[model samples]
Target: MSGLVLIEPTELYNILNQNTIYPCLSDTNFLLLLDARNKLEYDESHVITAKRARCDGEENFAIPYDAELECKTHVIIYDGNCRSLREKCRALQCANRMATDGSKNPVKILRGGYEDFSAMYPFLRTQKIIYLPQELDAISTYPCEILPSILYIGSKEQATSKAIHKDLKVQAHLNLTKSDDVFFDSAESEKYLQIAIDDDREADFGSHISKIINFIAKNREKLRTILVWSDQGISRSAAACIAYLMSYYKWPLKDAWRHVKSCKHTVRPNRGLVMQLSQYEESRLGSKVTNVDDPYY
Candidate 1:
């Protein structure tokens, strides 16, 4: 699990906002905080102190939910309106489960969300901000200089074109006859890619997931905005399975979904499986869940 679940927003705000009174309880121990905002938003502002949950494609390995810690206190901060924060919080809940029993760690969110945190803690603005220019300079910014967008080719390819028809910064195209194998290879080699195969069924792809995670972990600084398009077509089974596993780590599913949706890729979730995932989150990590977003550990 990546985060915990809590109902009270005020309590969480107290724990994170007023660090002077609450104080970071850990002594000679490290605190791991996750900011589940996109790179652009994170650059503008964030609070997680030790390490932010970076793009899985950019990160080489899953930052163990509970590894090498003298303390269990971990915080997850997310943007309120953004569903990614909630999704990420859910992941933290899963990670906490894989940790030791009788753990006293706390998982919290900020009150009033990202904007409120920025008011109390002003330093988050410079971390990784992205600014859009009013006009594009051909000499300064060329078509190929920025990240290449994901191109989708499926039965409903035309639908995807309409999703991003007006957005020129990212390109989305369709090719109906393309094969999954070919698409996977091309995306891996050409564009930033993160493949999430169900460990339960597609164990064969475990090595593949590991290899990619390792690559991202080692080269996190160079990668940005991963392209997620599964070869599992027309079957929500694969998408749901992948989303479930990806959600296990509290990844920003919205980013992933938005990326796919822009290409008109579909997501079909299993009712039973999705329910099971939610149940697992609530039962396992409910202890540490808080509604506050603590930017720095």
Candidate 2:
């Protein structure tokens, strides 16, 4: 992505004016925007209160410094005339580089700097990133009598249990194997047939999806239903890819989508992207239909 340089607040406003899809407009509307500058500058009455960034000096932390910031789009502002300008610009440039080079969202930088724009426009502080916690409304006192067999698909972000054991009340989890727990004991999880995928490492989704397909076909009759989940709802590309493959196997697009979405325990993968997994038209050979809900959505 090309870099944007705004000379004034109005210039920034004008750009934002046209891009209604951008998230910056709402913050400006509510006066909640933050200036990324020095504490002294902010305390002495700078245009916007400088929100300090968590500085690790590590360029590639699994999580970004501004990851905690509530907004979907961030407008970083600092004094162009100030000595720290170069440093700030360098950091922003690095972040911007990462965004453009990878399959991730681009980070925006404010051009005019904080000194020139802070007092020019009112800030909106209240609006921030907020994710509502999900609650399970329906309770199942006795596990629904479902299929006995399950196929396991492993990804970096989530740990879904095997289908066979899940019906028998087995649980599998992931994302817990972060950098902090490498030395810790994983014996308990090892007891069950658990496959741990490294979140930091990248793998080919095509091969992984093929493996899942082969596994499911091998135990087609034994498994009653397939459950899919991953971190970031629709964001996990691999999970969505797998879901797509499943849909091709005769699963209903909407039904498979809903099955994964409604799973309370399973990590909801990316929601930003559209995934239409085709549903299986006929029931599995040996399975008895317990619930009428289509296995695939």
Candidate 3:
């Protein structure tokens, strides 16, 4: 297997949430999360299921010999602030050495490390943890919320759930997938809009996005919450949210994407969709806008 030198925290989070059950690669055995911070830091706050390791002392960089490590398919090492040049180089060297030692397991360093991960998923932290309230549990069903208006990006299931709709008092629903799986009726208090689009590079979303933006803008004053959903709650819905932010708020594509991702860590628009958003930004700004690449993606 190929080794990955850097891994995104969102990717790691998804991997940990999978329900696969292989003999030698069960969920627990599938990953080895190593904390490259000091013992005190590890005790105070570390990634779930992560073991402490050192990268500063004489006997610092020894991989643990636990059974989980032996059977792990991937090894992820992370420090407190992985953005620093010194920490990045150290993590890279450790991952490279693991790869060179004839270990077929993919070894990776977490990008931006614990700092970024904690920012994205505050509930995972041991100290000053933010728990989701009962009312906001529906929002937690999806990866994250994209806006302060209780405007959320979620899966098709979440969009269709009547309980979630009632709990959040959702006023509007936008479905981006090409399916007739709508749950609410127009006669009801809620408004529903669906644009049948496939998640493909060639799928044109120009006019559809414009309509969706208009829909959101039109309902902005009257609605308390609007939910946008696709199949997996990752690609199409995220793209739509970004487009809405750019159109309604006059934000550049990069700034809008950053803001959305700050609220929803796993929102990754596909490359083609991102390119289209970049174009949309240029059109609105009347000039070419520089695309800021998401390093995590």
Candidate 4:
């Protein structure tokens, strides 16, 4: 929680995703990503929109544009392949300089730095440096990353995108829509599941909760990532993610719902599904753990 925080490649990728919980990175002046590598390496390619940070390999760092470092909510720095923050690595030097200059939170050093992040999120790597707000807003959207590399929730369109499938290598697709709505070829060892339910509160979705949990849990190790989605991805699919979290972690419905909703603000399971999940808490955990009638939701 103090000093430099090491962030994984998957975690950074989630924050960079356009369709994830946060607005596009370009839309906010609250994030600053500094590339601590040499000018030649930085000019070749770096993380998208990463600004070059001039470092003297010792105690000097010159940030670009005199960016209001005090205003950024998140500050991340990376170099070629620095592995640990304890070492006097280039990234650590850059991060230390930023912290000294007044970063609110501990400057995060991307684990394994540029090499790992760029390799894991290849689609996000770009040669372009300057970006207009409108240009970023018009960029393609990916699924909301719920559990880093493990789970994602998105729209049907996102589920069908070959680019997303290849980039994320999502091996399991859970479709929480009509039964006849088949979208993927399931090639490359990918698996698919259809929940076949309407978004209506009266739909008999309770029977499938256990199956949903089982499918994801069973294939979790074999898959790169699991993608769950409905036509629009805000209702039934969101509920499915909540159910999986509750079952997997044994968390109460309230806690699970809070965690999921925190990851994607757009997630809003219908009243009927909420009631079913509340009931599941009692049946599975043998105790009533959530107040379904509470107005907090």
- lDDT for model 2: 0.33
lDDT of 1 by residue, 132-190 (tens): 22211111110111112222222222223333233322232212122343223445443
TM-score of each: 0.28, 0.25, 0.52, 0.84
Kindly indicate the candidate among 2 and 4 with the higher lDDT: 4
Overall lDDT per candidate, in order of appearance: 0.35, 0.33, 0.67, 0.80
**RMSD values, in order shown:** 19.6, 19.9, 9.5, 3.4
Instruction: Give lDDT tens digits, candidate 4, residues 25-125.
Output: 75565579899998899889998878899866554887767677777777999998888867878888888888887787888999898998887678888
Question: Candidate 2 has what TM-score?
Answer: 0.25
lDDT (10s digit) by residue, model 3, range 106-220: 7778888888887765554553223233322222343345664457777776777776676556778788887665565545433677877888887787667788887777667
- Candidate with best TM-score: 4
Give the alpha carbon lDDT tens digit for every residue of 170-272 in model 2. 2322221222222113563322211233333243232344444443344344442332223332334335433444434444444544444332123333222
Better of 2 and 3 by TM-score: 3
Kindly report which residue stretches of model 4 are placed more than 4 angstroms away from their true locations once superposed.
1-3, 18-23, 56-59, 179-182, 185-190, 221-224, 258-265, 290-296
Best-to-worst ranking by TM-score: 4, 3, 1, 2
